[model samples]
Target chain A: MMCYIYDGSFEGLLTAIYETYYRKEHPNKILSITDYEKSFLYKDVFIDTDPNKSDKVYNSIKTKISNQTLKHVFHAFVSENEDSGTWIYNYLRLGWKVGKKLDLHLTDDRVLAIHNITRKVSREIHYMQGLLRFRKIKNDVFYAPFEPQFNIVGLLASHFANRMSDQNWIIHDVKRDIGVLYNQEEWVITNINLKGDITFAEDEEFYQKLWKEYFKNIAIKNRINPKLQKSNMPMKYWKYLIEKN
Target chain B: MEILDKLKILADAAKYDVSCSSSGSSRKNKKGGLGNSHISGICHSWSDDGRCISLLKILFTNYCIYDCAYCVNRSSNDIPRAMFSPEEMVNLTVNFYRRNYIEGLFLSSAIYKSPSYTMELLLKTVKTLREKNFNGYIHLKAIPGADLNIMREAGKHVDRMSVNIELPSNNGLKLLAPQKSKEHIIKPMGLISSKIVENVSERKLYKNSDKFVPAGQSTQLIVGATPDKDLNILTLSESLYERFNLKRVYYSAYVPVSKHPNLPQISTPPLLREHRLYQADWLLRFYGFKSQELLDSKNPNFDIHFDPKCNWAIRNLHLFPVEINRADYEMLLRIPGIGIKSAKKIISARRVGPINYDNLKKIGAVLKRAKYFITCQGKYYGETKFNEDNIKNSLLANSSDKLNITQGEQLSLFSLYPNLLPLPDILTKITGEL
Candidate 1:
């Protein structure tokens, strides 16, 4: 049995997928660089990142399958699904057979798995866009910190850029140790490490206090259903919510 | 009083207005502007009732001249009242919006000095927000009997506007809210609709000059408030949709906020009935189901046990067991478990190949309900036979699976003598859908 190992990056995974199809060698398992543990039972294949090869495979998919299918693949890769590498490989192979209508093959297990993963990633992005609370940090910058289940910093930055064009903001992904900084013009994703001790603006807590007050006052006393609230907003996201606090 | 104290009083007073959706306009951010509206609106928070807090929904002031029987802020009720100065209101809206706490403002006001007085104040607040280039979505309520000219000017600055028809019929309005008449409420609705139509055609003729009520108008009807039946309310709503070209008609379950001799003695709101009405409203808007198709004058209320769609499908069983693989989109949408999303998915998914139960579940259909109404290639896997009573029992069994498995007190009851059942069970059945 052979296990395929690649650098833990979306581009590297796509390149590894290209190699599997190019060499026609199917591996028993696919693991990211950090995911693989030292084991002697299976032969290991290390895949190097090659933009040329990745672009070739990407172009083939764009030409053969519809662009919508390719977009779904990218979103699925950003998801935290551990089996997403092999799943993408199987999905692409199926896409090659089914052409642009590959998404309609919902009965197939591999296709359905990819579809669910993409949906999950997009849903997470949408939820974070709404649920995230930004505070006025120093330098007059609006700073918000979150721990999303997917790598959605870029998506959130693009959305805020469209919505708040004249403001400077930074959305940090605490789990990924990366953040997107938008300086009232453009946004760039950078590796960011933060010190826990940080001070907010002088009137920041006042606005937050008002917000918490508004949140509490708006709820109807008779219609309090904590169960339904939990269903709409999972408890995992409560840590960053100022109102919940 | 301080703004903080006023916020608490105003927010508490505004809780009964249930038009919470912010999904209408898709106004883009102007250059150097501070905000924009997404095509699909955003919800900044959720209240305890699992309802969205999209906009900073609050009344500008609770002081009113009319003593509406159902209003908590009626003149005779003696509730704590405060008013926000136009400056204070503008500051609050901008600060909250910049903090990402709300999409925009849903500013509603009571008749302070006069309808025209309230209208001018509303116009002042929204104009200030727009002059500051706050391009966020604004849904301002139009005060009935306001000058048509001022209301139309107000429409040009905001994204969406609404004139709530608080009651279904003219008699109900006259009895509960004496100052408000059906003509007074609908006049602004007709004005807004005509201006929206004019803007559409004007934009088509010329290039562009700022639009008027670009998201169109919507109204709210208080359910369970009067003796008016669902048939009357729905037919009224259908006509509003046809005549006014309204964007939406919100149904707010009547929560008894004030005491009056005419009001019901019940303590809690009829949330399930409201849910059924919303479901029926969705059928009217998206499924192309007419109000007459869902309910008739003879049967003025929806069934308590099943949703409007399920009840319709159960009565019209000859239309089904529709072949899942071959059903048209409209026919597929008529099934109980197949929503717009699932019906569209079924159509696209079947273009690739045939689908069965497993695929149906993955494609987001509620198979527990759909199985009784649909078949995959003419094969039915439902446990019960093709009888209405049996299917109803099976559906109930699915809902109360644990109760049935534990041999709990049987819930089976024939409608032949529905009035004879115990009062507790009858109440439970009425609120069962929730």
Candidate 2:
């Protein structure tokens, strides 16, 4: 029984799949090098970082499966879930043998498990699209800061680009330290550092005052249930909500 | 007056309206307007109380002249009163919209000074938002007993209008809220509907006339408050829809705020009952179930355990075992657990070939409940008995256990047989259903 180890990147995982295909050696276990200390007691085979092998595997999977399927697998990898790496390895192996019809047999436990993680990530992306509260900055760029449970910064780009087509917007995911910038015409995802005091628009104080006023007015004193409200909008997410602060 | 202080007082008063939905309108920003509206309106955030906060729902004032018993803001209640000027409301709306804090405004108010004066103030707020600030997508509440001319002027600027038929029956209104009458509420709705129709007709001829209340109107009916049953409530709602051409009818479960001898002392609001009524209401609008078909004089109340559609289908077993391929759209809607989406899917899929059990699942049918109602071609996949009595007993037994879990009660034999054992005896034994 041989355990295959690769670099923690998604491309490195694809390269390991290339080796599994070429060598025809079924791996007993598949893991990332980050989990090396927790490696199982089995014969180990480390695949050296090879760009050509990674490209070949990426191209093969792209051609065999639809772009939508490849995107799901990529999202599952970036989610960094507990069993994500092994599930991707197993899903691809079965997918390659069965061809494009693998998604139809979702009753299989391994396939269903991967599908569940991808769905969670997708749902978070949809929720953030609706829940993202943007604060207007001086440069006329609308800025919003969020801390989503999953790394969904990439998924939110199209939503803002389509909805706020005529305006500039930036959604910064504070948890992952990444941001998606939409400059009216296009959008790009990049790393951002919010370490120091970040300055907002000059009109920030005025808007904040108005928003706080509106928030205070909307609550019905007759039915003030702090417990019920806390259940819907948890206290953990209140730091970013302007009204809550 | 300070706008901040007034907002706090007025918004706190307006929070109990429970109709904060900003959906059902597709208004866009005109040349000078600051914002656009989507047909499927946005819910900017969910409030802590699990309600949608799509709009900044608030009143212009909480000071009232009429003494309505059920209202917290009645003249007799010793609460602080406040009002916002039109300019203050417009500024707040524009600022909130720019910050992505709210989609639009849901402006309601208690009748301050007089009905005409309060309606004029509400109208001034919306008119300033549209004409002065170029704000888009305002949902204004029509003050009952307000002048017809004021309501007509309001229809021109706002996207939607609602005059809540608060109580179901005239007697209920007289008993709970003496100041309000049936005609006062229903008249404004009738006037608005006719004005909407007239405006639409004029637009068809002129090609550029401004839209009048493009989102139409809706009303709210408080559930479980008065002696009216589900049948009576639904019958009234049906007339409100057919006669007034209402876009929606919202049901708010009664939450007792004040200690009144007449009102029931419920520990928690009847949220589950509200949910079931919404399901039944959806059936009325999209599923083609009339009020008579859903409830009757014998069983006037909805089943507490199962949803209304499921309960209705189980009681009429003769209608069941419908062949998927041959069932018409209307008949397909009658089957339990087959929603509008699944019924449409069945129609479209069966056009190519005969549908089977596997095909039904693919079309998103809830087979756990639909199993008793439908058949794949000729083969019935449900339980063999198909008798109403047997099916009802089995369904109740299965559902009572699930209800116990949801109500945070332990599963006991006595709870499993609610009809046979007295509720007090069961409560003493298990201490559940508190």
The best candidate in terms of lDDT: 1
Q: What is the lDDT of residue A129 in candidate 1?
A: 68
The residue pairs found clashing in candidate 1 are none
Off by over 4 Å in 2: A1-126, A136-141, A148-168, A175-195, A200-239, A243-245, B30-33, B132-136, B259-268, B324-326, B345-364, B377-384, B400-434
Q: For model 2 chain B, give the 10-residue run with minimal summed lDDT.
A: B425-434
Per-residue lDDT, model 1, residue B312, is 90
Instruction: Report the C-alpha displacement of residue A137, candidate 2, in angstroms.
Output: 4.6
The docking category that best describes candidate 1 is: medium
> In candidate 1, how many Å is residue B373 off?
1.1
- Clash pairs, candidate 2, are A217-B11, A229-B48, A229-B49
Which digits, one per residue and each the tens of the lDDT, describe model 1 over residues B56-164?
Answer: 9899999999899988888999778999999999999888887788888999988899999999999999999999999988989999998988899999999889998
Judged by DockQ cut-offs, the docking class of candidate 2 is incorrect
lDDT of 1 by residue, A1-245 (tens): 88888898877888888898889998877778877886999999999999998898899899999898898888888885778887888898889988988988877888998998999998888788678888888888888888999898887888888877887888999999999999888999999999877789887898888888888888777667776667677889888888899
